[model samples]
Target: MIQSVRQTFNQAFSPEHYRAFLDKINADFPGQLDFRVAETPVFVPKVLTDKLLTACNDIVNVITRSDFKTLTEQAIPEGQRVPNEDDHTQFMAVDFAVCTDESGELTPQLIELQGFPSLYGFQPYLADQFRANYPIPENLSHLFSVANNAEYLERLRQMVVGDCNPEEVILLEIYPEQQKTRIDFTLTEKFLGVAAVCLTKIKKEGRALYYEKDGRTIRIRRIYNRLIFDDLQHYPDLKTDFYLTDDVDVEWIGHPNWFFRISKYTLPLLKSPYIPASYFLSDLTDYPADLENYVLKPLFSFAGSGVKLHITSTDLDAIPSEQRSGYLLQRKVTYEPVIQSPDGLVKSEIRMLFIWPKEDERPTLLTNLSRLSRGEMIGVNFNKNKDWVGGTVCFFEQ
Candidate 1:
């Protein structure tokens, strides 16, 4: 974080200004902002920015290896494997906790990585709103590898709506309207000309998928997948013509199989200075003496579900032996509360967003989303009743 920029922004900050900023954002898409928006954007200095980039590149090297698919063959759950996976994942979101090392210097520790799409459409829009409302520095920007907002959005459009009519490509989800991140779905439709179609509503005619749009049955040629198997488990009674595992004739912008392959399961396969020690729970014959330094995580859950921060030997024993392989034990990284706020400092997690076109050797880092948390973890429930703890974008020194 840059102290001069922080001081300048703090001097200009006010409750009224934040209220008006929220008003403008809400006005753009009324009643769609279901989550909190932080009062400020993070000002990341060049030093920390370089470290984050290095960590991302290290992880990318492992992912782009020739035998990556073979190495991650078991990552896909038996019944959940989707057909027609692309040559590579179109999207990659890598999360890092702003931490301090033994020398108390700023550093980034890998938290998690997902081969899935993040707030691709909403992040740039949020950054624009932040810039319009705040005095962001001229030398700093939220974009990486891209020049401006138009260029960033254009790259996103090309990846999601490539060579196909936008109408034939839908942002596929289950009960998308009811999802918490529905604001992103609205923005994707606005920016890319694709509609958010729920899985239950999709009609399966033989091997082809179709969805009705304004009294017309439109053929689905591609899907901007936003659905997760964890969320799908919540609706067991609902009947659907098309299932994710079905061999449908369509292209997946973000293939569902990569979601598992590049998730917590892949954390153990990765080796980086920024990456903490991670191991499969099943493979550990003897539990570590300092169990407090580790956290137990389910291999497939999203948004920090089934994560046990405080671990005990008894907790490890409680898991059935056969099910232990579906979990991971990772060393916990101490999140340094670096972002200065009016109330107090808050810990932040920076998620680097990347896009990999089929022709590219690896994914390209585009922009980032940073969350300020005043609680034990970074999420809505943990940061409830807290100020300056919500979703926001980061402005990196250019």
Candidate 2:
């Protein structure tokens, strides 16, 4: 964080401005935000930005393959496994811990990667609000190579919408307002001009899907999909038409397949200094004698639901042998909160956002989301009532 900007911003920061910020968000959208919005934005330094970009490239390389079709087919044994959970993971949130690499140099290493979505919509709006209310440095930016908010939106459109009219694309979610990440859906709708329609709201006829808007039925051409089928499994009673495997005519903004390809299961396959060494539960050559050093994670689960941190041999043994195949033993990389915390130093992980150009093979590092925590885990519940710890985007020096 730059001291000059911090000094200027702090001088201007007030309770009134904070109130206005919330009011502005409310005015911009008619309802509640899905995820928690922090009072301030995190300032990212140059070193961390470089490391994040490098980490992203390492991941993109593994996912972009000439023989991806064959590779994907081999990876999935059944029709259900085709998406590979982490495959068409449209939004890639690579969490990084600033750590010393093998050469003893400080570097950001991969802590985790999720197939889930983040605050793509709220970040730009929040960034603008931060600039309006605080004296952020001119050189620092929340927006990356794509210029300002409008350009960023266009880039996102290209990523998800392509040449299709924006009105035709819908940001699909399951009862979006009820989901924890509803704010993202709202933001995506606002910025991308895509409708945030739930699975229940979608109208189906033959093989087509449509949603009504302003007295008109807009044909669904593309889906900026945010629905998690895993959650769909929870509610077996509900009949929904937006099943990804249903052979719908619309193109997926974030292909469902990428979610399965680049996940905890694939982390073991990606070799990078920025990434922790991960082993398949089935393929682990030799289990660490000290199981305490690693965390056990199920291949497919969201928001740290199935992670067994502070792992023990007994904990690993308790898992049924049949179920063990679905998990991975990931070496724990200590995340040191180098960012100054108000009370004391707190650990932090930065989730780098990316957009893969349709023409370009690699996805470019765009903006970032940062999470601060005092507890061992980075979940919001773990850092409840904590200051400077919540859902926040980072403003990095360009």
Candidate 3:
């Protein structure tokens, strides 16, 4: 973090200015902002930024290996495997917690990585709003590998829409309008021509998928998939003509199989200085002596679901022997309260977004989103009735 810039921004900050910033975001897309926006954007110094980039490269090396998929063949759960997976995942988000090393120097430690799409559409809009409402430095930028907002969106369009007509590509999700992150869906439709279509809404005739739009049947040639199989469990009774596991005749921009292959299940396989020690609960013959420093995580859950920060032998033994393979024991990284908030210091996590086009040798790191937390963990339930803790973007020193 840049102390000088943080001091300057905090000194200039006012309650009225923060309200106006929120007003502008709401006015841009009415009622689309379902989550709180942090009062300020993080100013990341070059030292931490360089370290974060290096950590990402280390993880990329493992993911891009020739036998990466073959090694992770068991990651996919039975009866949940999706057909027609792409050669690689189109999107990836690697998370890092701002931590202090034994030397008391600020550093980043790898928290988790996901081979799924993040807030790719709404992040640039949030960055522009931050700039419009505050005095962000000219040298600081939230974008990577791109010059401006237009360039960023253009690159995203190329990956999502590709050679196919924008209208032919659909952002597939399960009742996307009701989802909390619907604002990104709205922005995705506004920036790109693709609209979010519900799974039940899709009509299937043989291997072809179609959806009714404006009273006309439109063929779906490609899908920018936003649906997760875990979310589908809540709607077991809901009937649909097309199943995700069914071999369909459409191209998948972000394949569903990659989501399972590159999730918490892949954490133990990764080795990096930034990455903490991790092991599948089933494979651990002996528990570590310092069990308090480790956390138990369900391999398939998202958004911090089913994660126990405090661990004990009883907790580990309570898990059925047959079901232990579905869990992970990850050493918890100490999140230093580095970001200076008006009330007090807050812990932060930076999620680096990336895009890996089929032709590219590896994934390209693009803009990032940072979450400020004043509670036990970073999530809606933990940070309720809290200030300066929610969704926000990060502006790094160029």
Number of colliding residue pairs in each model:
0, 19, 0
**Candidate 2, number of clashes:** 19
Q: Residues 77-97, candidate 2: write the lDDT tens digits.
A: 245442223323456767786
| Model 3 C-alpha lDDT per residue in residues 1-398, reported as the tens digit of each score | 79988998898899899998999989989988898889999999998899899999999999999999998999999998988887899999999999988898888998888999999999999999988878889899999999998999999999999988888999999999888889999999999988999999998998999999999899999999999988999997989999999998999999999998999988988888899999999999999999999999999898899999998999999999999999999999989998998888999999999999989999999899999999888888999998889999999996
**What RMSD does each model have against the real structure?**
1.0, 3.1, 0.9
| C-alpha TM-scores of all predictions | 0.98, 0.88, 0.99
Better of 2 and 3 by TM-score: 3
Descending-lDDT candidate ranking: 1, 3, 2
**Candidate 1 structure quality by residue, lDDT tens digits, 279-326:** 999999999888899999999788998899998999999999999999
lDDT of 2: 0.71
In model 3, where is the ten-residue run with the lowest total lDDT?
A: 79-88
Give RMSD (Å) of candidate 1 vs. truth: 1.0
Candidate 1 Cα lDDT to native: 0.93
Residue 359, candidate 3: C-alpha displacement in angstroms: 1.1
